[model samples]
Target: MFGFGIYDALIIAGFLGLQFFLSARNSAYWGAIIPVLFISWLTWLLVSGEIKSILAYLLILSIGFIVLLLEWSEGRKALRNRREKELAKMRSYDMN
Candidate 1:
C-alpha cells in the first residue's frame, strides 16, 4: 500500500515524536499528539483499500506535511538565533 511497510510506520512515529519533543515549548501538546494519531490513522486508511479511505489518507498526509514544514522552519530559526547568541557571547569575551 503506497509502498509503506511496518518500517515506514515506525519511522513516521519516530519522526513525529522527535518533532513533538523539539516543539513542545512552542506548540500546544495536543498539536503534536494529533499528528502522531493522524499518521497512524492514515496508515490504517491506506491499508483499507477503499476510495474514500485513500482520500482520507491523502488529506491526513497533506496536513502532516504542512506541520512538519512549519516545525522545520521554526527549528531552523531557533538554531540560527542560538548560534547568533553564542557568537555574540564569544565576541564579548574576546573584547575583554
Candidate 2:
C-alpha cells in the first residue's frame, strides 16, 4: 500500500498516536515541534532514497497536516471553554 512496508506502517501509526496524545494534553510546544521534526525526518528519508514513492510522502504529509488541524481546533475550543468558565466564576462572585 503506497510502497509502505510493515515497519513503515507501524512507525506512521505510532506517530499518529503520539500526535493524538499530544493534542489531548494540549501541549502547545511539543505539538508544534514534533510535526516539524517528523517533516524533517521525512525529507531526509526522501532525499536518501529510502522512501522512493511520492505518494507515500504526500500521504504522510497529509496525515500530519490533518492531525495538526485537529489539534489546533481542539486547543481553541479548550481555551474558549476555560475563558467562559472564568467569566462565570467572576460573575458568581459579583452576585455574592
TM-score for all models, in order of appearance: 0.54, 0.63
Q: 1-96, model 1: which lDDT tens digit per residue?
A: 357899999987787656655654454453465457667767766777542565667776898779775775565566667778999999999999
Question: Which residue window of length 10 is worst by lDDT in model 2?
Answer: 19-28
The digit string of per-residue lDDT tens for model 2 on 64-94 reads 7777667656755666677789999999999
Whole-model lDDT, model 1: 0.67
Name the TM-score of candidate 2: 0.63
Q: In TM-score terms, which candidate is top?
A: 2
Off by over 4 Å in 1: 1-17, 20-41, 48-52
- CA lDDT of every candidate: 0.67, 0.73
RMSD per candidate (Å) reads: 9.2, 4.0
